[model samples]
Structures are given as C-alpha cells and as structure tokens.
Target: MPREYRMMTEAPPPLEITDLTTTFVSRNRRTEVVRGVSFTVRRGETMMLLGESGSGKSVTARSIMRLYGPSAEIGGSVKLLGRELLDLAEPQLRAIRGAQIALVPQDPTGALDPLRRIGSQLTEVLAAHGVERVRGAARRRAEELLALVGIPDPKRVADSYPHELSGGMRQRAVIAIAVSCDPQVLIADEPTTALDVTVQAQILELIAELQQRLGMAVLMVTHDVGVAAEFGGRVGVMYAGKLVEEGPARQVLSSPRHPYTAGLLDSLPTPGIARGALRSIVGSPPSVGAFPLGCAFAARCPHARRSCGEADPPLVAVGADRVAACPVVNTEAAVA
Candidate 1:
C-alpha cells in the first residue's frame, strides 16, 4: 500500500501529560529547563516538539525517560496508560525504559559502542530486557529488526561494527535497537540531524512506516518545522523552555498564532519569498536561570505591550485542539 494511504488509516489514543517541569542544579544555582509543559500523544500518534537550540525540547524528552543527571530535579506528573511515572524507582523505570518507552538519541555513532558489532549491541539490549532466551534467538531477532527498519542485507550489516556503516545506516541501526522490544512510546531526539537530505527523508519515512506497523506513540523533537509537518499529526512550538503554541500540524503551520511561532515560520526560506525577506526572532534564547519576568519572547516580539511585560500569559485554547500562550493572539481573538 502507498505510504499516504497507510498513514490515513492508522490512528492512536492520546498520551496525556500535565504540569511537567525539569530543573537542573549546580553547586550554587538551580535552573528550570522545562517549565510546566503539558501535552498529550494518543497511542500511535506522532507529536512533534518544535523549537530552536536550547529550547528544552531534548530536556523534556530526557525528563520523560528519567535520564537526567543526578543533580537535576523533576516535578509534575508523567502518565502512560494512566499510571504515574514520576514516583517510579530506578529499577521500575528501567522496566519501562525500553519495553514501554524507547529512545533514539540524536547521534547514532555516539549512541553505539565503536568496539562492539551491531548485532552484539542489539543482542545485549534484548538480553537486558529478557526479550530473547538465547544468543542465537537474539541474533535472529536483531536481523529481523534491522530489516524492519529498511536496512539491506540485515545479517551482514548486523555483523559490521558501528564505525563501518554509513550515517544513515547507523541511524537505522540505532532505531532498530530502540524498537527491538516494541515499546509503546518512542522518543526520537533529532534522529536525522547528521544525515544528508536524501538520507534524512529515508529515515523519516522509515520512522513513519514503523510507527504505523508497531502502533507506537512517537515524540519527535526537531528544530525544523518542515520535518515536523512531514511526520507530525500535531506540533508544539517551544520557546525558552515553554510551549508557546500547539495544535494540528496544518493549523499550526498555515496560521501560527503566537508571535514567536510566526517569527519561526517567517524564517523558513521559500521559493516565492524574497531571499532576504525572512524575518528572524531577534536576541538569543534567555539563560534558563535568567528567564524574563513575563513573556520569554516579549523582548523580541513586535506585538509586545505593557500587559505582556507584566504577567506571563497562560496557554489558552483558541480553537479545538489548538492552544497559544500569547496575550496578543488571545486578546485579538477575544476582541474579534
């Protein structure tokens, strides 16, 4: 069947999150990287978290997996299948880590050991999870997974070391290992960052295909809106560690409500738009420890007013399944 046809047929339940926060602490200071972020990902649904660098997209993913450093502090509730995850112990969390929620980190090569063969690494994952009884069974399962991810000559590729494979192949291998246990949620953190454009598309296609076949929820963290639009059923735009806008992918793309979101969309290079016509969000992302008093983007936002500088706007529902944390969008819509 065609890819588009398959996607249209598959739908999943929503994954609910509420008031999630992650904080990093040093010897003398503490900083919150993810500030009261909330959203949902239905079973088998793809939700893209879009943001610029240092926007806490990856940190939010890490917090969900409980992979933060020891000094970090986590708050709020993260529920899967209606069970609270924040209170789970380390060992309990491990049980859910791969079997319930798998992660495909940004760098495939860095994720794998250079000294170990691809097959061995996957086998270890299987063994750790008790997914396979013996080495032979694990090896066969690993080959099957490699094939599932569209890697050619799966057995041969499995026997090769991480250093021997191309960038795209290595990423596929990482993904295969991640899904070896068929987890319910797959967190892909910039899964195609290092690949060329063609390879990137292939990887995205593979992910979309696998999500459909496995019926798993996907939390995709990306800085590229185009990538988000390609795979995400919903998109959440984050700025300075907060989710500023979220809605259906098409709605968010076609008519972004938040000024920050508009600025981001404006920055995208288009064939019709003049070469230098793109407008960028001015100023760097605020340091996590030194976020502005009211709106994080207010300093650079053209629509900023006295009210914006006085109180942080809450994420208000603007449309069915659409929310924007912007006073301007909210006030304008209210007036209309």
Candidate 2:
C-alpha cells in the first residue's frame, strides 16, 4: 500500500480548501479556471485530484500556492495548519511557502537551471528559508537531501549540472529540493508525467516513502486513475473546473456513482477488452469558462437525464464518506 494510506489524525488537517475559485480577467472575458473546488488533506494522507487535460486540475493546485501572480483573481479559503493563506501578504506568504508548503513540478528539466550545478539549486532553497547558513552547511545539507531522495552518488550528482543527470535523477533532485525544508504539505503536480512507465512507478513509490518519512500531507494531481488507485487514499474527480465526485479511492474507483467517473473507468483498457475495441467516453470536455448551465459532463454522459440540463448540481452524499454531483446517483440509490 502507498505510505499515504496510513490512518492518522491532524486537527484542521494539513491543508483545507473551500469554495476555491480562480479567474483570469482579460479585455473581453473573465475565465473562471477553477470553480468552487473543495477538499482536504490530513497529515500523512494523499488526496489525488484526478481529471482529464483542461479539466483545471493543475490550475487548482497553482491557485493554492497563489502562483498566478497579478493576472489571476483568486477567491476562497485556503487554510494551512489552521491559518488562512489567501489574505496573507506576499512577504508573509513567502515565509510559509517553502518552509510549510512545497511544490514538485511536472518537468524537472525545465524546473532546474542548465548553467548552475544541482547542489547550488538545492542550497538556494535552503538559504531562501534560512534553514542553513554558510556555504559549507548548505552544501552538506544539500548533499544529505540528494541522498535522502535516493541519488546513488549524492556528492557527484550535486556537483553536476541539471543537464548532466537523467530524467529520473533530475526528478529525484526536484523531490529532494521540495523536501529540503521538511514542509508540512507537498503539492506534486504530475511529478511522474514525464518519466517512463517504470520510472513513473518508482517516482510514485519515492513520493509515498517521503510522505511517510516526513509525515506530510500530499495533494497529487494526475489524469491517470491507475496512479490514483495505486496511491490509494482519497480521490477527487474534476471536470470543467468543478469537483464532480470525491470519496475513498477504492470506493470511488470500484463503485463510481458519477457518470463521468464511470466513463473514465470504462476508458481504461481491461483484460477482457480487445486491444482495438476498448471503450472511450464520447465528446470532449467543455472549453474553459464555457461550461453549460447544467452539469458540465451532461453532453457526454450516457445516463444524463432532463434534470441534468435544468441547472448545475451540487455534490450530494451517495455513500459513506462519498459524494457525487449527479442527481441520478441519488435517484438510483433510492430505487435500489
């Protein structure tokens, strides 16, 4: 089992988001990339945000960190360890950013600098938080971080530039930097997306191991249900900037109540299904900021009813620790 599956208690959770929305304003339009997405990650737990491309999963994660700068209009409650983050000033937020919360971005190559050695980058992070002063202490700490993330030759890797390392190694280095300060929460935005299948599994295992050792809450964003299933904790499914279904990973994946979730599961290739005959959800997701008044997935949902187009549905309880946004789920449950 993934390390994040371990049961634990942390009051107020490590991170809590409520009605989080992000909008980008332009001359002619205001695009709401994230719409009232809410979820929580307890200490040592992973909350996987699963969705397709353009579903606004990545935007939601960045919004938590307030990475959009002045171009985005963000509103909602983002609490870290019981303290609100949205209203904090930039200097105050900077203090909390790397020390309490960290981000493991998707492309390690792009994240790392080509000119500077890896050790310098890692030390920079330490210096930013005043974790270690003096060059010697910072270098030693950076080396230790590299070793902690499973770098074979920590000293050697640290001395090399970003382009000197392989894809997996660079990713490991990124993880090391993210954990250097021992943050309370780690937001991994597709940390394994660039690696091969085998490397992807290794990276996931590495993240789980680090989460256990550091005892940090993790918000992992990914499009792959298999990755979420392997991580095995809470699952939140998003579509058209809205959270459509959320519950325990096993329950949601096995007995998904929402039609969109069902479609995602059906799209995965199964043992019985022939190679070319695998099922796929018809129609693409609605464009950003252009979702219909009804359920965003109504156009592609096979079970969509007349009421689906009447108005957007709110997440309603369907089972133990589970909720789905489709009215049909409740109707089906009542009939059953």
Candidate 3:
C-alpha cells in the first residue's frame, strides 16, 4: 500500500508550550537561553524550528523534555496532553520521557551506547518503558521496531553494536528505539546533521513515513532553510531566543516578512548564482544572554532603523496563517 494512503485516526496533540523560558546559572550569574518560546505541534503535523546555532532551538527542545540538569532554572508552562509539565515530579517526568515523548538526537553515535549491542539497547528501552514484560517479548519487539524503521535485515542489524553499523543505520536504530513504545510526540533535534546528503534525504523520508504510520506530532529542529522547505510544514524562525517569523513553509520561503528570515533565505545556495558569489548574512549572531534589549537581530539586520533599537517588535499577523516580529517590514507591508 502507498504510504500516503495509510489510515491513521485523529489523535489529540500532546504539546502546547507557552512563555517557556530556560535559564542556565553558574556562580550566581544567569544566562537565559530560551526566552518565552512558544509553538504547537498538532497530531500528524510537523513543526520545524529553523534557526542558526545558539539561537535557543536545541535548548527549547531540551527544556520541553526537562533535560536541563540541576543547574538550570526552567519557567513557564509545558503542557503535554493538556497537563502542565513544568512542575511535574521527577518520576512523573520520567514516565513521560520515553513512553509518551521520544527524542531522536542529532548524533546517533553519541546517542547509542558503544558497549551494548543495538538489540540489547532497544530491548532495554522497551522493558524500561514497560512496553514488554518479559525479556523474550522485549527482544522480539525490538526486532519488530528495527524492521518498522526500514532496516533491511532487522535481526542482523539488531545483533550488531553501534560501531558495527553505518551512520544511517545507526540513526534508524535510534529512531526505532524512540518509537518502540509508540510515543505521542517525537522530538527530532537535527537528526540528520551528521549523515551525508543522500543518507540525510533517506533518513528524512523514513521519518516522514513513520510519522504518517504512527500519527505522532514531530518537532524537527534544523539550521537549514532547504531542509525546512523540503520537510513541508509550518515553520518557526527563531533568533536570539524568540520566534522572529512563522507560517506555512512555502509562504515563509516564498515571501519572508522579517529581515532576519529574508537574510536566511537569501543565504541559501542557488544554482543560478555565480561561483563564489553565494550571499551570506552579515555580522555574527549575538552571544547568549548578551543580546540587546530591543530586537536581537537589529545589529545584523540590513533594514533595521532607530526604532528597531528602541523597542522590540511583537510577532503580529502579516497574512493568513503568517506572523513576523518586525516593525520595519510590517510598516512597509502596510504601506504597500
């Protein structure tokens, strides 16, 4: 049967974050990394959080899973399945992490245990999450999971250790483990970052196939606009811990309202451009916790004016299903 034709019932979305903030503290000094980042991922829908490094995209994902350790301070609400997760007890959060919300990390080599075989690792996850009671049941379930993620030979792949498998295979194994317990939400944080271009495309296709099969909301984070465009979903452009622009992926790519977003799109490599003539965003990204009080992108934004430095622009509706945080662009749109 065709993947698109796969039947999936409507499942309630699990994630609804609001004013979520994550701060790291050391020696009494605090660095606010993710400041009031808000977004939603509905069932069977993908939400790509697009940004450059240090733009608080990864931190926001970690905060959603409560991965920040004892040193960090988290504020605001992270409601999963209509329940507030910000203040949940450790055990409660533990129950939710793998069983309800699964994460496919960037580096599969780092994510997988070198000392353990892939089969054992996945079996352990299944047993730990209470998906399977007996060892035999867990092992069988692990093999089924490996095959579910499109591994050619599930048994052989499962028997091998992380080092024995190729990079793409390792990623597939990681994903298989993530979905073993059938999570409602899958948080894929740059899952294809380390793979070659061909493998990246394959892995992304596998993810899409699995998302449709399982009917789980996917929150994918990436630095590439091309990836976001290809992924084909709603996109949230993050800069300096805030969503600068957000809308349908095609709309955002075709007509970017925010200068920062336009800069990112302009920076994509195009075949029409001459060799060595690739456009690049000017200036460096602001350091964490040191961003200016107003618009964080003002220093680097070409269209920035005096008022851009004076006050931060709120994310306002620019069109149907679109919003951007840019007074300059907004005013230009209003006039034109």
> Residue 164 lDDT in model 3?
95
Query: Whole-model lDDT for model 1 versus the true structure?
Result: 0.90
TM-score of each: 0.94, 0.96, 0.95
Query: Which 10 consecutive positions of candidate 3 have the poorest summed lDDT?
Result: 4-13
174, model 2: CA deviation in Å? 0.5
lDDT tens string, model 1, 81-160? 66788889888998888888899999998999999999999999899999995978889999999999999899999999
User: How many Å off is the CA of 280 in candidate 1?
Assistant: 1.5
lDDT (Cα, 0-100) at 214 in candidate 2 = 92
Model 1, position 168, has a per-residue lDDT of: 94
Number of the top-ranking candidate, with lDDT as the measure: 2
Descending-TM-score candidate ranking: 2, 3, 1
On a 0 to 100 scale, what is the lDDT of residue 307 in model 3? 84
Q: What does candidate 1 score in Cα RMSD to the true structure?
A: 5.3
Q: Write the per-residue lDDT of candidate 3 for residues 1-336, one digit (tens) a residue.
A: 665555444333588888889999899699999888878788888999999999999999989999977778999888887778888899899988999999999999999999999999998888887889698878888899999999999999988999999999999999998999899899999998978999999999999999999988999999988889999989999999989998999999899999989999888778899888878889999999988878999999888899888888888899998989998988888999
Tell me the whole-model lDDT of each prediction, alpha carbons only: 0.90, 0.93, 0.90
Off by over 4 Å in 1: 1-14, 334-336
